[model samples]
Target: MSGSKKTYDTDTVVFGAGTAVIAAAIAAAKEGQETYLIEINNQIGGVMAASPGMMLGAGYPMKTSIGGFFKDYVQRMYNHTPPLARRRLSTLENLGEEVVYDPDYAIFL
Candidate 1:
């Protein structure tokens, strides 16, 4: 293992490690597919991570919905121990459900 770079062989390779890509990779792997996620940046979340905060608003009034990884993420945020993280679930602040999280948490999720 001198100069050769590590390699991964997967049945499915999802580019980018954004929320959507992560969700897709999870879905694919769940279906028994060998899945891999690749991102150029050392950090994940892409533009979402760089932004100050993220908005999880409803596009269709109360009808807007989320499932899979998204739902799980919201649940995780809701369960976060810090008051700040918990506050993100409720404080509208002229905006709806905006979450301010540490960028390092992106990889954790």
Candidate 2:
């Protein structure tokens, strides 16, 4: 780390960790700005620690030709996750409805 160019009281400093803070760091780093994302916890993801699995918001997304950071992230998930990992499950236990998946996420725990 070079101390010559560095300065205190940064242009951007996001406290608390989670997807939001991580996103902020990515945005700042992509923008070529000096940024710092602080997390009280030792790990990066906060709520995601409790709630695993991809966010199903907007449903199965329509594929796009042009890719960005977020798109690339999702693409990595889709590609890296094996087909065998995709299993359906009964949701009557907790979700109060039918659900599908490779296995109940709780199985790991």
User: Which prediction has the highest TM-score against the true structure?
Assistant: 1
For every model shown, the clashing-pair count is 0, 4
- Per-residue lDDT for 85 in model 1? 40
C-alpha RMSD by candidate, in order = 4.0, 8.3
Clashing pairs in 1: none
The digit string of per-residue lDDT tens for model 1 on 2-37 reads 997987777999999887788899999989999888
Which regions of candidate 2 are displaced past 4 Å? Answer: 1-9, 58-69, 81-109
Task: Give candidate 2's whole-model lDDT.
Answer: 0.49
Top lDDT: which candidate number? 1
* Residue 38, model 2: Cα distance from true site in angstroms: 0.9
Model 1: which ten-residue window has the lowest total lDDT? Answer: 83-92
| lDDT per model vs. reference | 0.68, 0.49
